[model samples]
Structure formats: C-alpha cells, structure tokens
Target chain A: MTVPAAAAAGYSLLVLAAVVAPAVVLESAGDRGGVRGAVGADLIGVSAAVGVPAAVLAWRGVRRTTRAGRSRTDVWIAASCGLVTVAVAASALPTVVLHATTGLPVLDADAGWPVPALWAVCLGAAVVAGEASRRGVLRWLAG
Target chain B: MPALNRRQFLAASLGAVGSVAAGTGLGSQLWPLMGREDLVPGRTPELVLPAGAWSPAADRLTFAAVGDTGSGGRQAMAVADRMARGYQDSPYGLVTHLGDLCYYGSVEDRFDDVFTRPMRPLIDAGVAFELAIGNHDGALHHSDASLAEIDAELRLLGTPARHYTTSHGPVDFFYLDSSTPGLFGDDASVQLEWLDDALASSTNQWKVVCMHHPVYSSGAHGSTPGADELLEPLLADRRVDLVLSGHDHHYERTHPVDGVTYVVSGGGCKTTPVRPGRFTAAASSTLQYLHVDVVGDRLTGRSVRADGRVVDRFELRAREGR
Candidate 1:
C-alpha cells in the first residue's frame, strides 16, 4: 500500500513538473511570444494526454502487485508508465534549461535526436529497474 | 515444412493486401496534414492595385511587405489573398517578410503551412519573398537549433544569407539580421560597418533598410531600445529614406526620424492592439499588408487590410541630392 501510494504521488509530481515548470521559466525569461505560448500549451496537452492514462494504469498495476504478489505483466506496466514520465521530463529539461540560462525558447538544431535517445534509454532503465525490484535484486544490491 | 493449405494461403494474401491498403490510406491523409497544404485551394482572386497607382517609370520599383503572418490561419489566408490581388493589379516582383514566418517553431518545420500554402497564389505568380529573422522566427534570442533551422529554411527559400543587400531599379535595399548578438551592444559594430559600406557603395536613388526588429514602433512591443541605439545613427547619417520592420502584431508608420520613415507592416495575419506614441503618424491593429511604389524620388505607401481596405497611406520624398 505504501509503495503504491508513494509511486502514484511521485508520478503525479513528475508530470506536474514537466508540464508546469517550463511555462514559469519561460514567462520569467522574457516576452510570451506566440511560439512560446503554443509550445507551452502543447507541452501541457501532451503531458496530460500521455500522463493521465499511464499514471492510472501504473497505479492499478501497483495495487494488483501488492495483493497478488509481483508478476511480469504488472511490473512491465509500471515500468512503461515510468518510462513515459521520465522521457517527457527528460525531453523538457533542455528547453527549460536553455530558457533559464539564455532566455532562449528553442532547442539546439541537433536537439531532435537527444529526445528520442533519452526516451529509449529511459525505457530500458525503467524495465531493468522494475525487474530488479520485483526480483529483490535492488534491495540486495542496496544492502 | 508442410505446404500451406489453400484456406490459410488465401487468408494470408488477403491480410497482406488489406494491410498495404490501410497503410496507403493513412499515409495519404497524414502527408497533406504534415505539409499543411490540404487547406489551401488551387486558385484565389488576383490582387489588384488601385488605378494609376502603378508606377510607369522604368526606374520605379514596387513591392509588398508584411510580417508576423506565420499562422497560416484564416486571417493569414485573407491577407495573402489580398496580397495576391494587389500583385495582379501592380505586378510587384518582390515580397518582403519582416520575420515570424512561422509561429511556435522553426520555419523549417512549419514553412509548408505558414508560408508555402498561404502564399501559394503569390509564389505561383512568380513573386519572390525576402526574409528577416524575427524573435519568433528563431532570432538571436531563440535556441541555437532554431537559429540553424531558420537559416537553413531561408536558404531553401532562396535567401542565401541571413543578412544581405539586393537591388531593384532605383532602390538598394539593405536587409539586416538584427537578431544577431550586439544588436544593441558592441557586436553591432560589425553590422554597422557593413551598413555604412552598403550605403556608401549604393548608387541607387533610394536607400532602404529592412529588419525584423523595430527601431521606432508604438505597437505592443514598443520600440526596441537596442535597435534604436545601434541603427538610428547610421540610418540618420546615411540619409536612409525608409526603414521597414515587423515585431509588434500591428501596423504603424512613424513620422520621419531623421529623414527616415519607419514603418511597421506587421499586421500580416494576427492583430494586437496598439496605441500611438509620440513618433507615430498612423497606427492600426488590423491584419494588413503594405504596397509601396517607388517612383522617381517619391515613395508612396498604402496599408491594405485583409478585407482589402486601405487603412493607412503615406509618402516619403527623398531629400534633395539623396
């Protein structure tokens, strides 16, 4: 119960961070140009669209795991949710950092590749971390 | 392996055909959406300038100018329609874009929707467009990627350099990339030096400068202090006749600041409310475009709205010996 509640809260916080923080940073940077407004709205929309369902499914999986014990399917579902949340967070980090540092609202020309690569790495990491926790490997390793 | 049964073989073949058909249908629909050319019609009304407005002199040159029109929405289409109509009547060979070619992203990503489709009528009619990098168009204040993408897209649109000079019959137009660093600082010295050279070498009767930032504007963005500091001295010293810009989403023409008429023809697609400042001779928040006719020493300018209403008009006569 505690694990599920904590995970859900953390996931929600991650989504909020990714969607809301960038807009604040950008507004503080300078004028709210049309592009920044559109991009900010888009980030919020995409986060809500992808985050809500992922969080719900992840919460359900965590609850089932708590009652029925760890299962491969349940772990995978939770891992997928984490992957999505992390990927979105990672992708937005560059834009936010750039705006904060230079008051620029755009990513670098080579920025497109880093986002997809981050997503892939996040997906892999989520899967590995989920499997390790389910197997108690993370607990043993931590010890 | 055993030979496939007749039933299984038929089902597999049908599945393959069905999959291919579905993929084809989806691709066809997605392609046009991505290109944003789906909404643009094949033909639109040709734009016509008013009677006797077209300059008959061989030395005279005509062009259309607008900015902040990257929306590719209804208002943008309406303005583009009017521009096409004006082109039909006067046959202007060039169009000047004052930046913000595409809102919310690099022009490379939205060029099809924001530029190609909306301006199709004019493009097909053989009109060439010159671009200035605006803040929304990925200027110096935007990310490096945005700047790179915009530069690449500009090249694709036939602008070889971000800042360069081009000439018409009697006008030497200096296109400055004001989005670069030193816009108000020492870095502007490079552009200032180039501008000084360009003005000095030009043998044309009329000298004009175009950039994305406004040096004298009363619109929402008001005047860019840096641009005023860096460019005004050069403009006044060289006796430049006209300074064209767009950033504030409105139209404004200033009383000559040191003999240079500052015009903000930014009402290309979107409209933002504006109040007249001390230097403003005329100002409006209508979606509009500008048609300028350079005949002899006089430059006649008309601001035409999306619905074809001429909202503002003014003239600038070159000073003696300019």
Candidate 2:
C-alpha cells in the first residue's frame, strides 16, 4: 500500500531472484550433465544479474513516490512492477533447475530461455527508467 | 484532506498500467527460453534469407566455406559479394557456412540487411548452402542457444538425409551434427556406429566429415574439450581422410592426425585473431572459403579468400578399399 513497503518488497524479490535462480540452474545443470547444461545455468545467472538491478530500481522508485505523497498511484505501480520482476525471475526457474541439476544446456532439449530474458530486460529497463525520469521531472517542475 | 485531484488520479493510473505492462509483457518475453521469432529484428538474432531450392554444378563443383564474417557489416558484405562474384565467374556448387550465422547467437533479431541482401548474388545463383552452428550463435551474457538454433535450421533445411554419405565425384562427403548432447552419449553412439558402417562400406575414393563444432580449433572459441574426448578417437580409428569445422572463425589445415587431415574453415561470417603455427600446417584469418577439386582418384582442396585468391591447398590421396 505504502511506497516504502512496495519498494522493500521489490528489492527483496530482486535479492531472492539473484540467490535462487542460479542455484536452480546449477542444480538443473548437474542432472542433465554437460557443457550444454553449463551454458543453460549460465543463462539463469545472467538473468539474475539483470533482475537484481531491475528490482533495485523498482524499489527506489516506489520509495521516492511514496515519500513525495505520490503513493496514491506510484505505490500501486511499484507493486505491479515488483510482481513483474518476480515473474520474470520465476519463469526462468525451470531453466535454472535444468542447468543446475543436469549439466546440459536448457535450450538443448527443444526449448530455451534467453530470448524471453532479453525481451524482459529491455522492457523492464524502459518502464523503470521512464517512470523514474518522469517522476523526477514532475518533482523538479513543482519546486 | 481535499479529495484526490482528477489529474493526480489519471497520472497515477497511467503509471500503474505502464509499469504493469512493462513488467509483464516485456519482462515475460525476456525469459531466455523465447523462440527465434520473438527477438526484435536487428538486435541479436538476425533474419537471413528465406529458403529456396538450389542446384549444384554438374562438374568442377566449387563452394564457399566461410565463418566469423557474421558481424563485419560492410567488410563482411564486401567479402560475401566477392565470393558471390566468384560463384558467378565459375559457379560454386554450394556455400558451406561454417557457423556463427549471426553474431552473439541472437537468432532472428540479429540479422541485418547487410547479411540478407549482400549475399543475394550467391543465393540467386542457386548455390546450395550448408550452415553449421557456432558458439556466438547461442546466447549473450547467458547460456548459448546457437547450437539449438543450428539444429533447428539443419532440420529446417530439408536435408532429409540427416547425416548421410554422398559423393560429388571422386570425393565422399559425410555431414554431421556435432553439438553437445547429440555428439555425446546415445546419439554419439548411434552416429558413430553409422559412420563406421558407412566408412567401411562406402565405394567413394575420398572420405570427409563436416560439422559445426571443431575437434581441433585455434581461434577465439578454441577447441571444445568435449569434442576431443569423445569424437577425435573416432576420426583416428576410422582413418577418416578429412574433417571440416567452423566455430573458430579462421582457416586452418593440419598434418594428418591418424591419417586424417583436420581443417578449420570458420571464416564464413566473421574473423578473429587466430593462434599461428601451432597444430596447423597452414592458417589464415581472412574471409575465405574452401574449394575442393575432385578429379578421379586425387582430390585437391584449396582455401580461397573472399578476394578470389586461392590461399591454401591440400590433397587427399585416394585409398584402395573403395
């Protein structure tokens, strides 16, 4: 409901993603077992790398909005964004599991996760940056 | 407190929708498992050309073998055109794309006009193509998908004789898919059996194997540890005459290993620095293709650069069993 609360949740989700996603991929890699799996796990790790930064931004944005009495709208936006971050990280869980458990590349078995991860990162960055910039500008203009 | 202002409510609603949309649709798509078609055009995966039928030369067959030329933009195009003109001057049998069909292995999005249109001459001239998958053909900053894409393309290429033995004249050719899981375990077991049977029973004079990953490489990607451990012994044991690969993005020919000549001609799309005078008898980093001349019992192979110069040459002596 509040900006701070939403921001905290976003960051928490980010940390969770960074820690858990790679573990799953590595485990998956071990099970499948090979260079292919290693590459697959690596993809999970890459997603985490991107996801962590996104989570941090979402949190900071929410915090700033709530503090500025923009919580009526910014809080909800931040919450929704936070959920998106978690979902993106979660969707990669199977791949992380595959690479972490098996030692095979996740994409080897007829499916892959890299394309979706790429698209997500681009869209996430755009949204976060757009909101953050817009809010900052509005605040400045008001002053 | 005063009731919420309409403008504030409107702005907030817009931000919420924007954030959610950004987070869901775009972020979901970024999942890494997304297909080739999902990638934005001209980003990572590039769209090359649509599929078409091609015919090989009846005699004096020639084709371009290129690798690592996927990213040079203008330079790559120039090289491709030169090869195309060469194809025109003396019609090439086919264009054997070594690998890294696109840089960073981004698939559909990575293709550009330079790659698609510049090689038009070759495509239009009816030069059949054999493309292998490269490391860069996979993922970026993440797991590589290029190998999978290569496999998909291979199947898509409609070469129904998946991993078959064929002849162009005096030369016998064997095309293989040597990617990870396939090259190892059960798949390897089956293919190896097929290879041994084919090599033992074939009537052709010269035998050669083609694949995407290399059993020996000295380029940026270097040798695949898995390949050496699993596949090299097969080559040596079979006394296979020649092995051609593409992942390294350079051209190299080696002294016969167990009576087999290992050639790395990965310069199809881009060029990277290569380790010199190591295992190779001859090597180059230029955009080049291999032209094999099969005349009766003697098969001569030349590495021709994009500029139309024959850069390297070797001969495969015919064996008696066939």
For this target, which candidate reaches the highest TM-score against the unseen true structure?
1
List where candidate 1 sits over 4 angstroms from the true fold: A1-143, B1-58, B180-182
Q: Give a tens-digit lDDT track for model 1, residues A18-135.
A: 3333333322211212222322333334445444554454455455655566533334333433434343343334333332322121312123433223333433343334334333
Docking class of 1: incorrect
In candidate 1, what are the lDDT values of residues B188-280, reduced to their tens digit?
A: 778788889989888789988889889988877888977776779889888899999998878999998888889999987666668999999
lDDT of 1: 0.63
Q: Estimate each model's TM-score.
A: 0.59, 0.52
TM-score of chain B of each: 0.81, 0.70
| lDDT: worst 10-residue window of model 1 chain B | B34-43
Candidate 2 stretches greater than 4 Å from native: A1-143, B1-60, B104-116, B136-148, B185-187
lDDT of 2 by residue, B1-322 (tens): 4453555556556556755674565345533232111111111222233333224433334455665556523335445755655554555566666656655334454343324544665665555666554445453222335445554545544444436666664556677656555455455788778887877776666677777777877777787777776778777776677788887767888877767788898765445557865677887765667776655566688887655677788887765544
DockQ (C-alpha based) per candidate is: 0.02, 0.06
